[model samples]
Target: MYAIPDSRLPLPQVLDRFPAGVPHRRNHVNDYLLVPREVDYFNGFLALLGRAQPPLQTDQLATAARNLNDVAAGDTPSPCIQQRIQHAHLLEQLLQDRDWEPSADISRELKLVVAYLHASRQLIPDTVPGVGHLDLAIVIDTAWPKLAAEVANFVDYQRLRHLEAERQGRSDDAIAFNRSSWLELREIEARLHEHQRRVREGSYAPEPFTYFRVH
Candidate 1:
């Protein structure tokens, strides 16, 4: 796990402790495409998650998952609501650790992302009629892709562990990796491969993959 600081990046002295420089308050929702600075901010956030250091909190992930808690709904395809709900579900699965255990470092990053999700005075507040979740969406968009592989691996590991224990007639203390998680992990793997293929065949240069895992 990366040793990203538990405290946010310090404000520039000139900003007088204003939160525009803060991760939760940066208001990246103003632009449809990420501006260069927004890119820098999110990239730094990712790097912080990937840093090989002690985790800040394993329990913090629940905070984010709670925000994503869903109300009863019919099968609707509202992208914004559905998208956030999905993101929340992912966080919830990891937080509950039904499948595999994450190291302290991975938990720390997850905690940070959750904290941002639940911030009351974020870049855009939920009180702002239609556009409130934009900031949350943007933050998730920036952060979740990097975590795709780790989530996938954890799910797979749990599945393998289940098999190993079953074969050896050992106790399976961990919850069995379910069909939904397996499917989600497969989808993540497919998307990652497609991304790599694009980098290989397109104009972009290939970069090494990085995430909060130690291995």
Candidate 2:
């Protein structure tokens, strides 16, 4: 398993710092559900996904937890919630891309998170009056570090492939190479550009052989 740093897991931070102040106080039921309770429950759902066996009778609490946590957390002050949710769509696209090979753990995590994003009734249902996507935002924020590198690399691969396709007058899908091939192509292009630069510089002769010039 790839070693993810502890900081990438938001649970610890949420546990340590939340329920401590205005926005996340335990008495503030909406805020409480959105911050720690729902997030904690969602983490449990992720655990369930990793298991091979079907959920046990006792595992039914996850369902109950989801239902109990079904809350309409009123408006979030954070403006980034919409943008963050949109970014989740990008992760969804990355998950769907057959050519990209994320690590097994990452792939599984993405599948589960993306499944939650698509679910009709999430911790805060998408149709809720406000803060519908806040839970998703929290989940994605937690998982972002894990997904960030793969998403960036996939995006770069797509860009280079698209440019190559345009040069060849073909569709992006017509390119038959994968990430490794793209890296090789990028390296070759870099080397070729460096060689061209050296050639250009070599064309310019020094002002003169100073020793040979009259003093």
Candidate 3:
């Protein structure tokens, strides 16, 4: 497991501290979408680590965090609640099934939940009170945690693979190849982060969810 030295450090500072070209990867399909509750859990986990990284990039991470948590806890459910509950159930089932072990990564599982939430936003009608204009902050608030988790997991997996190869006495050439692949993944992650940053800045808008929107 990768060690986080100080969770109190802000996310931007953490990103700045890491080398510019470290590799990262997208999460597996099943674990891509995260529900609001899961987002709260993740942020709390970050707080426990002593670093404060919020999924959304707005200056007010704490407020954003609380708002999402509130949404999850409130009695009147968000329009996407049913879908999220269903997705969560499916995930729980998959996680419980031992036959699915080889295909599972806890990080990926979490990411799929994030992806589902992103997709779920579309389930709300354009006529819905708060969702009509689909704000970028809302999108980022929903998407960033999964993206971050995927990148982190990619790094962790590569590190473990490299160590395993070294222990197995793999040829130096093979090890070099793995390292190169890992570096490429890092580059991909950097691009993803940049892309997400742009999306947050309204440089790009997500494609409309044809199937998700309630007509």
The candidate that achieves the highest TM-score relative to the unseen native structure: 2
What's the C-alpha lDDT at position 50 in model 1? 57
Q: Which stretches of candidate 2 lie over 4 Å from their true place?
A: 1-16, 19-40, 46-78, 193-212
Model 1, TM vs. native: 0.37
Name the regions of candidate 3 deviating beyond 4 angstroms: 1-74, 102-104, 107-215
1-215, model 2: which lDDT tens digit per residue?
11223333222123213223333222222332343455456657744444332322212322322333443234532344555676688788778777767667678778877888888646656554344565576567656757777767777778777778898899988877677877987888889999999988786666666566556
Model 3, 113: alpha-carbon shift in Å?
A: 8.5
Whichever of 1 and 2 has more TM-score, that candidate is 2
- Colliding residue pairs in candidate 2: none
Alpha-carbon lDDT, every model: 0.48, 0.58, 0.39
Better of 2 and 3 by lDDT: 2
lDDT at position 102, candidate 3: 18
* Better by lDDT, candidate 2 or 1: 2
Which 10-residue window in model 2 sums to the lowest lDDT? Answer: 9-18
Per-candidate clash tally: 5, 0, 22
Looking at model 2, residue 151 earns an lDDT score of: 69
